[model samples]
Target: MRNRINEEITLRKLEVLLAYMETGNLAKAAEALDVSTVSVHRALHSLEEGMRCALFRHEGRNLLPTEAAHVLADVATDVIKAMADGIRATRQAAGYSADHMKIGSLYSLTIRTVPDVVIGIKVRRPELQAELVLGSNADLLFKLKQGAIDAALMAMPEPDPEIESIALFEDEIYFAAPADSPYARQASIDLRQCRDEPFVTLSEGFITYQGFMDAFRIADFTPNVVMKVGDIFSLMNLVSGGVGYALLPGRVRDVFAHKVTLVPLSSQYRLRQTIGLSFLRRRERDPNLLALAAVCRLAMRVPS
Candidate 1:
């Protein structure tokens, strides 16, 4: 029956038949397929037997292909191409290699941490393209959990079973003020001293925002926050323009060094933010995530 014929005709046999047809000789076909001439001849013979047809005509020692052989060769080519495409599509759907990777991070990290990780990833995976999605710590963590990004670079969250983290470096929050402000001249500023000063802060979800609240809590009073911005750069801009003072991580000190001055907080109000890489525990074995983790591990060894 047709089912029995189908079972006998394997994709390997079709590949052999195509090779023989293209090369026009059993020896040449064997060379192309890296198989012995006898093996190539046997595969072609089995293919003809499965189809129950004379696909070639023997002209002395040479076997010339028949019109039926040409038709079958065309169909075999299409089948092989389709199967290859299907495999690629399936891998992409499973979050394997699709030639691109997405990484999420806090906007503050764009100054150093994100760039370092991304460059290292590119060095390890030369063909992979990377896309960066910047947002608050909570926004990035949400995106990481939803599978919208492969990984995130941000302040490490409290331990969770669903997430795996690799600590890269630690940064501290500082009192950020205009370059011309009196606080910028001091070796360190006390949060309690600024209790009555107007302040600008990043919105609720940012990692720096949490540090801001914690430091102020220790100082025992609420700051007079005049405005809340969504990003660190804008908040720094507001501080630079003398709209209000703000608290920021030390990471951005170099970025806005000329515009704003970051004065260290006194010992009582000092808070350290541990920055690191985070990904879903289930995807720990993913190739891209593995490469990213390796990069972070290397970074930990180097002085920052």
Candidate 2:
């Protein structure tokens, strides 16, 4: 029983077996492996002894595979390919060695907060390279899961054990409409006032979208959405064109300044979203990730 079991097979032996299987001759396998023919012979002999089976049969000075050898060859190919893939993945995760950093964020921040924070990061670490990827919040989250991005700016919800998050800042949602529209001139508007109005809103899966729904639910009203767009910009664009009103983050004021007007929602049902910088908790200790987190922490501080 002991003899039937192969001892631990080393990668080198697997390579030798694969090379010999390909070349069909010990001398040729040796040349391909950059080793002496005697060494190749010894490696094959050891493998055969461990497996208690003849891997190759002697046929007039040529190597021919046994049935078992053919089966093992297929397995070896898959194992080698998997090992190669792992190496490539590891290299990609390490990213560039320079002081550069790559960060991703939801579209809402792409226009203002993200740029301001990046400028702050550069001012502190001018030697660092900063790369930004902008996408819908859901898309950015997927990229973080795939390890394609190092960190992201997002709104927090329930706890995800695999992720770590630190609150960056909090901004309230406001009702927005075209500057010349009647809704814009109002000092405050009841959520019920817009309940029946045509509404343009963020698409599903965005934190803001959920917040909007929750706010309406609290007021015992459901917004009659006329259109659903993927990002804040599009939702606001539709509002600016007098298409409908929308619930948008306060930061939108900084970007769409004179294009739209904001009305403070009644405080009874005001919705606020907290934005944070998040990354895989397991990688929090990584030097590059840690440095990026530090920059984010500093950027979150309100200017005195």
Q: How does model 2 fare in lDDT?
A: 0.80
RMSD of 2: 9.8
Tens-digit lDDT string for candidate 2 (1-304)? 4544356465678888899999988899999999999988888878788677888888887768899888888888988889877775774566523365679888888766687778877776777788998766677777877778888898874688878888888989898889888878888878887767888888887888888898889889778888998778888889888888888888778667788988899988798889988888877777666777777777678621
Task: Count the clashes in each prediction.
Answer: 0, 1
Query: Please, what are the lDDT tens digits per residue for candidate 1 over residues 1-304?
Result: 4435556588899899889988899999999999999999888888888888988888998889899899999999998888889988987676676678889888987876677778888999999899999999999889988878878988898898989998888888899989999999999998878878999999999999999999889999989999999999999999999999998998888877898999999999899999889988887888888888898778656524
- Tally clashing residue pairs in candidate 1: 0
Model 1 segments more than 4 A misplaced: 1-5, 25-39, 57-63, 299-304
Off by over 4 Å in 2: 1-100, 123-128
Judged by TM-score, which candidate is best?
A: 1
Q: Can you give the TM-score per candidate against the true fold?
A: 0.87, 0.66
lDDT for residue 95 in candidate 2, whole number 0-100: 53
